[model samples]
Target chain A: MLSNKKTTNEKEIQKLIEELDNIISKKENILEINLDEKIRKLAELLSSSNSLEEINNCSEAIQRLAVIIFEKTKALKNRSGILYIDPFLMKLAILGSNIEKLSKAFIQSWRPVVGRDVINLFLLKDAMTYWNSITKYSFEAREEKTIENVSKISFLDERGINEEIEEMYNELERRGGKELYDKLIESKNLSEKIFKAVILSFMITYGYVGIIREPLKGKVWVVKKEKTIESKNPESFVIVVK
Target chain B: MEEESTKKLRRAAQLLFFKSHRNPGIKGWELRKALGQDYTKILKKLEEKINELGLTIKIVSDSGELRTLSDPHEVLSNCRFFISINDPLTITDLRTSGWSIDEIAGLTVCIATIISKEGKTTRQELEQILSQKLPKWKATRLLSKYIKAGYLDEKEDYIVLGWRTKSEVDLENIIRYIFS
Candidate 1:
């Protein structure tokens, strides 16, 4: 019975070494990631190498880091403050290993409020939007690209609520908003119809005017139409929504 | 990698298409009304996926114009392959298309109504008849209605036997029948 007990303990020690080696493989290249003070103390215990108590302590530290990463992702999405969107996406792309249950658990931890379905929907939509913008990026040289896209797209903390509405009013004055607005407002549900009209009118205008983008920040969807029908559909001509 | 993305999108498309078909013969406008503004973009993405899957979508407009009213009712009728309308494609339609009803419903009485000796009805014909003649009932509801009405008999497939009119049964004693 004593010999059997010794063999079981040896097997458990071997399993602990394998788990630590796997964890280190992922962190090897990430040089700046200093272990937390608590984690450092745990590592001191782990230096003894074969102690079962040290293995348990190291496991606790790994669990803590996972929880921290999960919480940080959730907090970033909720409070929008110029998050490095691309880098954030890169981290997300690396998630989900061969283990299905672990990946699901990780996603569940990261997005507590939004369910998996909602995250999937947003990811798909966002991916399409991102790919569309990236297609526009191929024109410029490499070094100047990052500065142009990322640096320009940053937003200020304070902006007027009516600024968006005023921009529309100004554009209308220059390009006969009266004629378009009058027809749009004629619908019984004026408010609802105006929203549709605004969206339609802008799409028509942009289709004629090539949209400009300012990298990492955000890009406008612009489509430039041919010259023939330009004047006939002036409302359908150059439009900028943002 | 692109092929994988295309496959993912196709799976998503099947979900969207099947879900939209639950309301079979649903128009783009009706889908917009039901699913909100995202329907057009969602469908456009699905169409892109279908194209990636080596399928060509010919946008056959009723009139050659910039904008024409799309009749989903007509589209569903004309489209036969991998296409669906607002109504759920019944077990009967699937059976006629060479799928065993048992595959989907398992061992059950598959009840469907056919118009007086018509072997099988297209979705368009069924919709029109259900809406005009049987205005009170919906097409999906007819599965149960015909079953209870004794107009539809269930076996390996749904067989529509003729319905018994009230007047024909009491033809000999009209006065007594009316009084009773």
Candidate 2:
């Protein structure tokens, strides 16, 4: 009679396991399952059974049920304000619709925050005081050796620079209106080559010439600008004489 | 005494409406310092005053979620307060507020995607989802814009709903309207 009872208990535990699996794997709404009752039944079976296999199966089922319950509770907590819709269906709806319609749908549900930003007299006064304090301290000028060298270079004056740039622009135009930067600076004397590069930079800066540096091709070209466009924003780049 | 209370109410309104920080809205402590210890009471009065103009005050907790005034006094004091419209906005209103149609559509896709994924998704996943409806470049740009606008938060790789979304957007209604 005791042996017969053990067989019945084992069969019942197996049945419960199958049911729990079905509920977990097949049901869309986990809330519909009475997971608490299932857990209670598993506990009762676990205590009554002397057989090791039946006890193990019951414990495992209870653990799986407990995990599902925990997940459901967490999901519910996170979704306190929002409703749950199938993610796949939501993606379908979003992808199937046109932008205009989707935007209209979104606006129908959006409540934008509205606030004002004002600059009052106190704020303006505070700003003025801060500015005044900052302006009281001027930036100190630092003397560098480069400044002395630049000062000695008399040809760097703004007055005659424009005419020299014009002459270089004419020379570039005579040479097919476009010449390789390296070729333009090619000379036996290193000083002369450096001087020519300096002039080329001035021409590029004054908008009389444009430099096209193809870093990938390892080449630089100096193209004459058809019109003397004012270089309001000049970009600087280095060209190796070698 | 009535005149004093009225002045405090005006000060509270200014603090809530005028942005004094990088983020919109004023902290509860700042309000306390500016309007005295009875700042919550003043905010209650301000809520009533703004209600007439179809506007309302929103208090968000330090955790970046909306909180009711019924919370503990300490929690309430730590919360941030801002003004928001009482009613839902129309498309025309959004346009006037400087949001382009593509931007509105893109933001909707992003928010909905994040919510559907249990309130968090990856940046790459979001970008891929958005690229379906927009050019890859535009999709990337729009994602950054939404993040900057406080509609979405980025934590390393994950993208979660932001404080602005919590206070302003009706996530339930957005889902319902879209499915409907």
Candidate 3:
């Protein structure tokens, strides 16, 4: 009867050792194994063993089992939550030979979030109201000093057109034809300056004045033409009046 | 008073639907300032109203975790509120939204690999895994796109799931489907 009991204990120890081996080899999921049950069975076996060799064998199995449990518990404690992944499934799906199949599997499961940007009248109105409330400064209308109407200098009128051109030419000649274009057009009133610029353009157009621009120096010299000669090729250039 | 409440509800809906910040959601305090102190009640009403339209409002905590309305008002106030479709999109819908199969597959691989690695992995490791199926350059570019789109985040050398993934993707269900 004692021999029969010894054999049973030996068989149970062998089965437990095989289970532990499967877990250690990662053939079975560590999380799925009943660790507490294994420990209890091992404790029962240790208590029932008749020989010193059997006790020693049971203690060794228990020590190995304790180490496995300790490692697993430490890993679990480190994890924030239970995000379990089946190692076999991961290998088969992600590291599998067929990547297209993995993609299809993802497509089958993906549920993308749906949200769109939208603008509505209600939103616009709220925005406007918010803007109006926060904007404390009123746009004060300072009376823009009305450009005082200077006596009409009509360069376009045929009656005074020649007189205007001649006056501009004589002025250019008086200034030694080397007056900077800006100095010639400079006036206290903006309108008067613009008027002078317009007349200067006409003077250039009629061949009474020629502008030599030193682009590097950014200076324009209104050289008086020695003789009035109609421009064979009159290229239009812009003269901005400040 | 009824008219005032209706106007507040409209204002709340408009605030949520029209994104004003760099991100797609509005903060709880902004809603309170717009809709009044009873913003939580207003949000609840707005949530019900949107639910009928097959839309839903999701609240994400400041730490990027999803929160429900059942959370305390103070907690909800600190959270971000955004709207999304209640139902998942079909594959055809995904294609229509300009997602290619390869890109989808690549994203799946990244998300799955990250989850397997306890929600974090090194960028070099992820790239190596991706390079098996895709060209090295393509994998690198795809990872950048994912990071930019808030699907994955890069912290120094480590890559973790992004806020958008936490708000949108159902990780558990995705894993189950992959195995299935």
**lDDT, candidate 1, A1-242, per-residue tens:** 65665455555545545554454556432333444653554455456446565466456656755655555455445335331223333222222112232222222211111001323453556566545433243433344423233233423111321243344444544554323333322446744444434444433443422222211122223233333133321221222221
Q: DockQ for each candidate? A: 0.02, 0.32, 0.17
| lDDT, model 1 | 0.35
Superior candidate under DockQ, 2 versus 3 = 2
| DockQ winner between candidates 1 and 2 | 2
Ten contiguous residues with the weakest lDDT in model 1 chain A: A107-116
TM-score, structure 1 vs. true: 0.16
Best of the candidates, DockQ: 2
Worst 10 residues of 1 chain B by lDDT: B104-113
- The C-alpha lDDT values of all candidates are 0.35, 0.74, 0.72
**Off by more than 4 A, model 3:** A1-74, A77-82, A86-89, A97-114, A117-242
Better of 1 and 3 by lDDT: 3
Best by TM-score: 2
lDDT of 2 by residue, A20-119 (tens): 7777677456655667677778878888899788778888787778777876777567557456566788899899878887788778777677666577
- In model 2, the Cα lDDT at residue A128 comes to 67
Off by over 4 Å in 2: A1-69, A76-82, A116-242
Q: Local error of candidate 2 at A9, Å?
A: 20
lDDT of 1 at B165: 14
